[model samples]
Target: MAKVKGEIVINSERCKGCELCVPVCQQQTIAMSDKLNSKGYHYAMSINDECNGCINCALVCPDGVISVYRVKLKDAAVA
Candidate 1:
């Protein structure tokens, strides 16, 4: 079976920007965004094309703001 690629989403509102998820991810997929949230703190955001579906970001996020969405596969045969 082939592994499918996915993307991880982080919610800016709930994030405290504690820099907690930065060291947890082995792939270094998550990075602090320049934009600040409503709380005026720089929140962590995933770099483009960096996530590898390891779910490390989701697991480490204290605010439960991370979400993983798998890419849909195209059907090889016409229905």
Candidate 2:
């Protein structure tokens, strides 16, 4: 089987800095930004490219401002 990678996109402006997504990320890909959004809240940001396509962050986001994508790594494909 091919290796799967996860990509996460966060709507910073809409995020409430609730920190709900931070703990759910097993890969530690999500983090709170020091910069504040228009709402004066520290929005969530992708700290690394280690996401494994897990939707835990999105599912835990109360604002529904998180998006998750999955990519199959061709190099790890099965014969």
Candidate 3:
């Protein structure tokens, strides 16, 4: 199985709640939160297990609020 390693950041204040990122995500990792932010808008959050670090969310974000990062995995010790 391929390992997915990355982080996503959504600027809730900048988000327009258009859900443009929701459908484009192939992994179905991105979703709109039920809780509202200070701007009274629902923001997008990612499910860790569902995301594959494909960077689709960032590409779909009109406000440029989304960010993606790839994590470096530690190598296993040689026995």
Candidate 4:
């Protein structure tokens, strides 16, 4: 099986800083941004490129602010 990587996108403007997405991410890829959004809240941001596309964050996000994409690692052998 090929190794999989994930890309996570968060709509910071739409994020309400609910912190729901953080705990669900086992990879700890998501975090609250130091900067504030237009709504004056610390929005969610991708802190690292370690997401595995589990979609747990998306499922827990009440505002639908998260999107996840899965990619097969180029060097990984496929069977």
Candidate 5:
């Protein structure tokens, strides 16, 4: 079986800083930025590479600011 890895992209300008996606993430990869966006809000950010492509954050985001990408890594023996 292959292992799944994921990446999360966020449009800081589009984000409203609602913090809706923060708690929904099971991996706790999402966080609020220390800096503010152009809209003067703390945008969402992926704090680490632990994302599993769950899409929970994307689904909960009202502004559609989050994007998730997943890749599969084959076993080392197979590689």
Candidate 6:
């Protein structure tokens, strides 16, 4: 079976620095940015490539700024 991978997109401008999604992510994929957004608030961001599309962050976000995309990669052939 192919392995699953995921990526997340966050709308920093809409984020309100709530940080609600930070601890809920099992993969530790989400983090708060040091910089502020256009709204002058810290926003959630995806820190790494280990996301599994669990949608925990998205579900927890009150502003609904997080979006997750998942894909499956086929295994490489043996040499």
Task: Output the better candidate (1/3) by lDDT.
Answer: 3
lDDT computed for candidate 3: 0.78
Indicate which candidate wins on lDDT.
2
How do the predictions measure up, each by TM-score? 0.75, 0.90, 0.78, 0.88, 0.90, 0.88
Ranking by lDDT: 2, 5, 4, 6, 3, 1
- Name the runs in model 5 displaced over 4 angstroms: 77-79
True-vs-predicted CA distance for residue 55, candidate 5, Å? 0.5
Model 4's alpha-carbon lDDT is 0.89
- Candidate 2 — which residues are off by over 4 angstroms? 76-79
Q: Write the per-residue lDDT of candidate 3 for residues 1-79, one digit (tens) a residue.
A: 4354567788887887889999998778789989887888898888656566778889978889998876544444111
Clashing pairs in 5: none
lDDT of candidate 2 over 1-79, digit per residue (tens): 3288889989999999999999999999999999999999999999997899879999989999999999887873523
- Model 6 lDDT tens row, 1-79: 3277888999899999999999999889888999999889988888997898888889988989888898876566211
Cα shift from native, residue 63, model 2 (Å): 0.5
RMSD of each: 4.1, 2.4, 3.1, 2.6, 2.4, 2.6
State the C-alpha lDDT per candidate.
0.78, 0.91, 0.78, 0.89, 0.90, 0.87
Residue 47 in model 4: shift from native, Å?
A: 0.8
Worst 10 residues of 5 by lDDT: 70-79
